[model samples]
Target chain A: MQAVEYFEVECPEALGGEYYKQIANDVLLDHNLLKVIDKLHIFIDPKVPVFVAVGLLKKISTRVRVGDFANVNPLEGKMTLVISDETYLASMLKIFWERFGKEKVEQPDRFTVILYNVPATPKEIEDIVVGDPSESLHKDLIYALRCIAPEGFRLRSEIFTGTKFTFVASENTLAEDIDTLVAEKFRLMGEVPP
Target chain B: MTLVPVTYKGGIFQHDIVVDLIEDLGGYIVQKHIIAQEVVLQCFVPREDIELIRQISRPLFGEVTDSPLVGTEIAIVSMSLEIHHLPHPSCDIAEYVRRLGAKSNMVSLARGPGKRIAGLNDEERDVINEHDIAVYLMGNFETCIEYKMPTLRRGIEVPIVLCGGPDKEVLERIIDPPVEGYVGNVGRFMRRTKEADELAKLDEIIDEITRVLEKKREEIAKDPLSVYPARLMGLIREQIPEILDVTSPTPLTVQIAGLRVKLPYDTFAERVKKVAIEDGITLGEVAEVLPSRMRDYVIVKVLPFSETNIAV
Candidate 1:
């Protein structure tokens, strides 16, 4: 298996080369995907009016458990969660309210949540999933790729997986030859076909 | 005499006094946006009478600020009204210009997509020419923008501003004749415009548009229009009360040479032509009333003193 490496953009159309690279970088930065993307490659041909992007995402094995963002402590009759990252506070409170009862969940401050009469242990509470970053990361990746694609290249096809993604867009209806073109493009980037 | 465009912002209470004062001063209210409690009136008041209107508005706790493009109309052109080209950036540009006080009309060309096949026809060009300035929102490619410019310049007489997604350097090299200015970073966008950088680019387009209008203003000053289009618009409103029934925004829409009354042409053209001024001279003698390019709206083109042998 080939290990993921770097990000690059190639344009046969001289004028679009630097412009495409700059925007593609911006879109990546905007989505905070620089860390998650191990390697990304984009190729554009303005004359043919085609846009293609292929990337390998760093694997994320763990879900965003409550413990990663908050400190869950078990009290005598209540469980108190002191959230370190306020980003997941709303979802954490909702999960507690749903799993326990709305009456059992009380938040006095912005980042502290207390739950009363909780049967679950600290480990169990800590195991509660707040969200999966990969889901939204995938979505943001697609959005960023779309932003980089030229506006008139409406016809699109995308393949998304746990660790890899490929998107190809064109002004015309994509033909079978496009797959061959994509393969040739990947070959140029020294990406071995699956 | 130069007319200044002013925006009056204040409480809605006793706002009619301000409106009445502007009307009495021969100023036309281009547009007024009123919520439950606040009102904003965009007015084109004569330079000599600006201080008078300001004094009235000041005592009423209303702020009067200059709105340079108040009565002017701008056409925001795009390739098509379809999902591919319309919403993302064109609508945002139109909304921004409208906020700046110009009456912005969104003009989408019939066959303005695909660089090889894109071309704008005469009618589309005429519609664009009617505005004080034309803003053509173009795509990323240099070749395509260069290809599209000739058709726009050939048919439209108004100054054109090319706004596109590419870098200014790339656009400047390609864009030629009839293009007043080139504004970059405004083309096809994927999301609702919120970025400060994107907004700054829109502001640049607005500034270029203002510059274009100023150039046209300087040219018009050489031999000014028969009457200030706004003043004529105000007169038409006062003389023809029937226009009040027209529900369109700015029923008496003003252009550089004339005004387009958004009333049915066949029934109202004769009445509009027969509108009399203070001299007992009818509009028919000083202007030509014809069917407008838009729906059945009547177009009143005020002839110059050289043509009509009458000056307002």
Candidate 2:
């Protein structure tokens, strides 16, 4: 019935477990990460002073590229790109300057950009990958996890792949087997440790 | 005179009459303000004459209700300013108590999280004790709240009203002294307390606070102070013209049992003690003027009749 397919919280204290589940749901929903997370499992040990969270992310089918957010047109040896979405404009400009140099790229206005004497065709420019939603999603997802974690659990260890993530936090230094704890949580969610 | 605390809210029409009536009856008008078209008055009137005060306000389209918090300062205590306990229930509790005529201060403890490593220092405890009472905003877990609270509550010397997530009956069942100062369902808001249920819970918390304040009033009534705090506010302002220059909006902030004079204690403590009252007795003869732990302000705690053998 919920957007997320699976969400589970495990703790020694029953009330603490229920409260943490509510907190996790609220934090994820507030951060707009509920839909993108397919499964989430959290394990908290107040006595042991550890909190572990493991989550499986939904498959991101759409890869944002230059063509997806801008219109490309060939004019002589140069190409002009008129951006329709500016959410990734800053990152796009950074990539352009790094790849084609500032001398070859010129942004005249907010949405207009001109490439001069580029060897690549307009189609090649359109194919350039500029935005990765998963990259920012990982950051936001980790932030929401921290919000869900117990207060004063400042020490953190995080692992974020394109399709999976595991976050461990503690008031003291994290345990040496923090990965095992995360793997145990992932296993609770019916996922392989890998 | 049996002073009964109350508040009034209605139109501005004939509101001056109510003020005049309170003054004529020798009652105190603690605070009165006009917010746009409406006027709000928080005052204390003679107990037997309360009906008369209400009757005079009826024609002004105003209502008078008993609310002991009208002239007191309250502290809303939380674990810390961390994401766990701040800007949610702390803000909500402070706003609710302030809306009901009490001066509410949000007091966030410096290290008031985690059961083993959490505790409040002497200064933090004193700051919270400066108010009439403290309302502790805690998290959702029942066991954690019970176990972790005493550490955060260390050295605090004031009545504490708790607001948390666990059901009141359950909390009262477990906590010693039978927890009359517990309000539930107001824990850790993801948003503002704008929803009807959230506001209802806030109202419940305020009602609990009023009950606690009324209890304090009853205790004070047993051995009444020689001079009421509100009366001293006027005397302090009149005799000590220097207080008028003080930047605090309320130079003599009203507490349930005393007053917090904003003047520096080192220079003004002796001067405040020498303030003369009725019957040829100096203020020092009937009250204990102590250097307040809060900002070195002088605290004028009027002696009870049992101690001073005088009552006004």
Q: Could you list the iRMS of every candidate?
A: 4.0, 2.2
| DockQ of all candidate complexes | 0.14, 0.37
lDDT of 1 at B251: 89
Looking at model 1 chain B, report the run of 10 residues with the lowest lDDT sum. Answer: B184-193
Off by over 4 Å in 1: A1-7, A12-39, A56-148, A154-167, A172-181, A188-190, B82-86, B152-154, B191-196
lDDT of 1 by residue, B1-312 (tens): 556778889999899999998888777787788978999998877789877877887877898887677777899888888655556678988999888788899999887865655778888877786677888988766766777667656768778888886777778887764367888756555456788887888889889998888888888777666666676676788888988888887888776667878988998888888877658878888888988676677877777767766767
lDDT of 2 by residue, A7-37 (tens): 8888886766776787788778778888899
Shift of residue A63 alpha carbon in model 2, Å: 5.9
RMSD of each: 6.0, 4.2
* Docking quality level of the chain pair in candidate 2: acceptable
Report the C-alpha lDDT of model 1 over A1-194, residue by residue, as the tens digit.
13336767787645556666666665667667777888778888767667888877888766789889888788788878898888778788788888888998899998898989887889998888888777787788887787778756678999887777889988777777777877766676677533
TM-score, every prediction? 0.74, 0.84
**Reference-based TM-score, model 1:** 0.74
Give a tens-digit lDDT track for model 2, residues B4-35: 77888879887889889988998887777799
